[model samples]
Target: MVAPMGIRLSPLGAAVFCLLAVGVIYHLYAGVISNRYAAFRGRTSVDLRDLLAVSVEAAVLGGKEVKAVRDENHLEEKSKGKTREGASEPLTKGDLQSHVKMYNLLKSSFPGVTVNSEEHDNLEDEVTWSRQIPDDILAKVEGGKLVPANRVTVWIDPLDATQEYTENLLKYVTTMVCVAVDGKPMIGVIHQPFTGFTAWGFVGQGSNMQRRSSYSTNPPNVIVSRSHPGQVESYVRSAFGNGTTVILAGGAGYKVLSLLDMPSSTSGDMDKGDAYIHITFIKKWDICAGAALLNAIGGEMTTLRGGRIDYSASPLNTGGLVASIGVDHRALVDRLPEWDPERH
Candidate 1:
């Protein structure tokens, strides 16, 4: 003998259960199924101009984090030791905080795109961000239409010149972001937290900053890193005579800004160099944004051997970098001695 069990539900209860089931199903589709289907089919196209605008916002957000850490006097240093080339690698709380902010902003804005950041620790953070683009940034968009999300790569430097930042040289600190499409850097945004100055550029479109009116390479006022001078000074001297002015500075972003006609308040009296040269090993995150900016304003940034640096390649750039505006880049490359990994 078998006993049969029967279940009964009221109309209201039945309706409520149905509604809950519908909600669960809807969430499942929206959160998981939809995304999987999208991936299976193809990623939706993203506008480069919109991406640039978002990158600018991300950079500004990172700069705010940096400034907040410094203003709060939380400049705690976490020594990353030295690189293979013997250059000091300094990390700070500001770097981590800024990196988290920038990484979140970019990932949230475009989930499918690849984001490469300078700081790689404590990356799992949940943050909400608004998708609204600033009116000023929106107005600058022109001609850059939709492109596949997978074809883009973003490089971020949350805090450049940590050593100088630790020394309280606030003017040299910058947070930068770059958008590279199809392995080519197409957009750059650099923000100086201390000065509240931001410069953005879109290659082939235009830039908010202008070239230095006095920018020239006649005597080649070259900017070299203060932290890692290496043999760059001697190379510059050999390339453009001993009398050529060599400006020692901190931060690749600041050096690139020196090449631009920025306000004296932001640039200070550092004798804005017409060219920026670095011989030692440098990370792509350190230089990608500056390279994009230079490319936007009819400037050139390439290896000392005058070969294009592919953004999608390895993060480390062993080849020396040289950036110049309002001058013949190839001519400058020709003057510099051939880059030898073993020698200068």
Candidate 2:
């Protein structure tokens, strides 16, 4: 039998030892979360949540330290004939396309993550996905990913609300990055890279928002685009006219990012709860990742008429959808005075 040492472990020491053991075990388990699954193969079996997290990490995780310079060399290439059906100006034809730069930047952080785009022929659905991006765009998009139910493609009037970004508008062009899964937003992640603002929602868990400010609150804030106006403004005015106010944000991502924080106006209005949910205007690429993020965070996504959006089958998946959180949803829709909105 082993003899006990004179220095017996006190209760406190014993408790500390137990906690250390638990911590060590947790650390080891966390380190192996992805690896164990690595050997667990199945092309379509990857969890949307994990993949979404990986994508966000890839896009943002190391934004500062790394500087991805735009391929000015592609300027001449862009002048050539290559074009992605609906790419905006300035991004016209290009050889060493900006996609190469974006892909390289993403690869630097995502490591093995791949991006791919191909002509998808979903005969059953009668849709196709295509784009002539630099080959690198194919890196991160895997073959069997869980696409948002309602894939959307949005056309922002201009990049970053050119006029506002020029004047350094704190918030202008703020809009929604809407996503839907089974006609509801399963994930949504709105981002404003310039301000490092990110708002995400995953159905079943909860929706959260973050901003550049060092402040925090628990109120519902409504986002409005100074450059892009929408019925949401009318809703805000109708709902809380005197007390509630709409904040100006630039870009779809910026609008959703603002939702992450309870705005100043709604600071103590519990009656207001959370702001409206339907972001009618949506663009596919604009909301693809955002929708995925929202789905991962536990939220329902769907078209205005509540239809599923298959992101995988098509490229230009632009459509209208709503991302709601704690509001009289059906009642809100009923209020819309549209003769054929029933068909939207």
Candidate 3:
């Protein structure tokens, strides 16, 4: 009665206060000075930890101890459950075939798509044009760079390393889709589609990747492609500068995912930003899904030229693009046009 003038408190409120206090105290004990220092609760989520190791932690909602938690369509895994037509197709071959199928589909869907690629007539387009169009007619040279100049989806099997996708072949593949607009990639879809996983970004729209444990999975492991092509060497050199060690990963999507793997890094810790390996010699389709996924998760994807990729072009979007996690991955690409990975 004597304290009736003060705000009333309930057990819930007391519990909340206790949690807040304890968290602060623990944070202090751990020298956790910023939000980035706070530990993340899940394996795939971006959190305080800086190393995003390949992990599949338990579900967060039930606080239960399960084997793993997955967001998106982690159900369509090749090892596990759902099965669809052509499900067993290898990533490299499947993606190549899918591009043609999608290209043909797009030709009917949009009526303006041009196919490029002919290695496999399984339905995929020719190297730079659909089975419907001739290669010479679609091919063009811009500033000495071989530009297919076709506004359509282009397929790139950057690194078909088996080690990366053996465990989760459907979830991890070095495949991309480019959709150009005005001579640039407007929409790019880099999908580990078989796993129902993906990263996508568009010009002016933004970029991001999907979390298999769901986008909500905490403390995700960021992966880099084990092998980046010669075209990408210059951009990689630019992002890492003179002495940055490149961490080889499995797929292109994984390359972009590497930044979100380990948390704990932020604005002040600039090196954390620099550690990212830049994929600059990218095409529209090559980074579409990854771009969208990264953009959704506080990242970026653009041309080494520092402009947004346009998607509404013809044939396909075959320009040089770069994908950066959270830093100026292009800072290297932006300057050294003469960047030659062979020199290294």
Candidate 4:
């Protein structure tokens, strides 16, 4: 064994020792420090909450930017043909260029993050999972396991309700983000750019509402998509027994907000009334954010036949969906025609 040398340290030595000790301590508690920082920023996922906030701001601003430029160029009429179903606008000429540009910029920051956006379909870019589902939620999923970050996926609708937006129906347009692990949506964000209203929710952490409102009406208001208002009338009649009023609305996210009964009035005293049902066969991006909101508030959003949607399975929800704020979900689902998963 080597004998200890009794060499005394100078002042500089003590300072260096203190610095090294502090560094080690910080390193030991690095996770705690990181958690605190996440909390301070009102975030939990490695890059989710902050990414959503930034993406939303960019989308909102981009909408305005695009609209302003459209007006200046008098391209509104010229763009009409492009908005139709199964049509494409020549990107080389009159592209709504800002939408993809803003989305790509926001997405690029999170290297290797898998994303399913309305503007692009690139499955190869899906990244590994870097975050775990919260304990409370994870406990409920039978044998649910957290995989690598590369398996995680995010769905985005940078500008939902494109037709409504082009028609100048500003309230209907929204920006949406949904985070899924394996094939389940665990977090969602919905932002209405024009109103600057936002709703967000995570699996176990609950939800946040920029505007809070309650459901207090008896008859229960039902909102339907403007594009497909008549599709669910019979279902509504069957579910509510012919007394509920159907309100034609645009955008799945906006309609979900209505179901939340958030007050839209400036006075802030008006009652939004109660909402009981929203049913549609829209895309995953259209309803994923809404599902998060409904789930947080103890509401239910399931396939039209009342089946759980696996977000990772497919972007198109051919089976349709029924979401509700108040009522027995299973009972309502049972009321529909004989459930057929294959037909959805």
Candidate 5:
């Protein structure tokens, strides 16, 4: 073979080659190479703590939309249908607006994760919200771990108490977000629009709120839905005693707040609720955030049958629910009558 001739590139050619090489390296690092490294190391691409922080912000954004709608007197309401108990299921402009805001924020922040929202309507253009976690909140969740994007499901109830909102029961209104990993709720954020209060928790981590001192009241004061109190009052009385106090409330989020001793904005005092009971069909989005918060604080929330509610399953939770803090959960379950789907 003949001796090879030497080749040289011009300055422009050299510069172009360097730029193209850098672009290729960046693409590999941003996608294929990084993904393979993560898989090999069994590490998740998304941090659970960051996701939780973003979710808290998303809830606050949704709540702002809700409050704006009502405060501006631009509330518009319609009934989707009647509930199983023949109660009107209300949908409002605030609900849809809040849903859009929350959904867009989550989707934009974590494009790979799955987000489930109660309202199906996509009414407005997508909005961009900050993914940056505040320094204080980030410090609190510093030790939090990571989870695979596919394994995490974000459940959102942009407007938890639409019926109450329509009736001007603003104290019961809340925007909630729950991050469930492998069907177990791991993080929760609840924001009260009118009160400008926000509470958040991460399982195995700390929370922004503390368990109430009166959480273990004997013959516990049971909280039930004022809108759909289907035999829950009687069930609570039967399980504990005829003298057991039943506190009727509007929203599932509000009931959980009461149990946590979060002062009611309207009353300016802690709402009296030791346990929350529900015998009718409830949506996962309505209760998932509360369940996660309870779990974070060493509390328990389960089916009246003492079964774990799986968020990966159907959105509807047909089984009865009972949640309490600083109480014997199993004993409470053992005392309650078996929850029959056909019968209450």
Candidate 6:
């Protein structure tokens, strides 16, 4: 004979179930509600940059194999086989792995904010201008033009040093993001994953966690990429003369960080001080974050010909750039050759 019994939940069981439900609700609130910073949109972008840096660093440390992917257009459609113009090669999977993480995180954090990340740009109208505007950026009015922070674009580079990261040169790897309004950068965030350091700033807000010393060296030590040397050696030799010292490093973000006097073990070394020069047409994601930081320290990042960067234009920086902490930036720029070797 089979005995039929009614299912019953004991008081202890009910209490446990209730606690579990409460825990789940609390976690959801923490992720969605508590993290909802609709008003401080600029700060939100900076925070997300830090989150991506931490996430990517954790993935690397956890022994997860990072597959490399290269998409010249820097679009989010690597999986869909779509890329922006001038993309000649296939996307690398490892780079896409980090890029996807950053894209999703930003998209989730600032629901309708316009994101113009290197990994994704052609977002639907469903995902634009849904977040609050930062007051500092909103208050900015230049040459009779009111800054439209509400309709700004957020540029992100989830992982900057793809090749260096693959080669285990972790120090050079960084996560970078910047907010631009009407083609002008208003805020920037740069995070070095391996070093666990982040630098962020908004125009007129001074700096976000960056320490700088008022020091300059004669002959000026220049920072150049170890991966892409280009015509840097000859240019420095001719422009600054043979007395100029060149420091070889990987990643554009890292090179700019050094220019900002970012706190590092080697920061105390006065030898590698002064400028960061790139002769090749670089992607905007690689320069925007660093440009914001440099601007915060009373520094300037301009084309070698002393021209301004227009973010609203194409993603490529055609004129090349020279970033310097010194006020004598014009003198520095005058030293460089007129044409970019990669371009001309």
**Top-scoring candidate (lDDT):** 1
lDDT of each: 0.86, 0.38, 0.37, 0.59, 0.85, 0.62
Q: How far is each candidate from the true structure, as Cα RMSD in Å?
A: 6.2, 19.7, 24.4, 12.8, 6.5, 14.8
Residue runs of model 2 more than 4 Å from their true location after superposition: 1-50, 61-167, 170-188, 197-222, 230-248, 262-281, 293-301, 315-319, 339-344
Model 6 per-residue lDDT tens digits across residues 1-344: 88999788999999999999999999878777644655565343223333223322332321122323322223233333322323222334545565556555555555555666666533332222224433333343122223333565667776776656655666777777776666777667776555555666666555643435654546778888666666777787688779888888877777777766556553443234478887766788788877876776577888888899987668888788888875488888887877754554
Q: Which segments of candidate 5 are over 4 A away from where they belong?
A: 1-44, 263-270
Cα lDDT of model 2 by residue, 1-344, tens digit: 99876877999999999999999999989769876656443222333444334333323422211112112222221222222332232222211222233334333322333332121111222111121221221343333445431232211111223334334453432222323343344444443334444444445544454222232112235555454344556655554443555565544444433333444543332112133234344445444544554355333345544556665444444445544444444544444333222233
Tens-digit lDDT track of model 1 for 13-130: 9999999999998987787887798785456677887888788888888899899999999878878999666877889999999999889878887888889999987576675456
Model 6 ranges off by over 4 Å: 1-94, 120-150, 209-211, 214-217, 264-271, 341-343
Candidate 1 ranges beyond 4 A from true positions: 1-42, 342-344
> TM-score for model 4?
0.65
TM-score to true structure, per model? 0.86, 0.45, 0.41, 0.65, 0.85, 0.65
Q: What's the count of clashing pairs in each model shown?
A: 0, 57, 97, 11, 0, 9
Candidate 1 total steric clashes: 0
What lDDT would candidate 2 get against the real structure?
Answer: 0.38
Across 1-344, the per-residue lDDT of candidate 4 in tens digits comes to: 99999989899999999999999999999989898865654422344444444444544544554455445654333333342233432221112444564456556555455677766523233222333433433333333233444556777776676656656666776777777776777677776666566666666556654223444334456677666543466666666668877676677777777666564552133223234344434578778877866776677788777789888867777666777766666765676664343342
- Point to the candidate with the largest TM-score: 1
Task: Please say which candidate is ahead in TM-score: 2 or 5.
Answer: 5
> Which of the two, 4 or 5, has more lDDT?
5
Q: Which stretches of candidate 4 lie above 4 Å from their native place?
A: 1-47, 58-63, 66-95, 121-147, 210-219, 261-280, 339-344
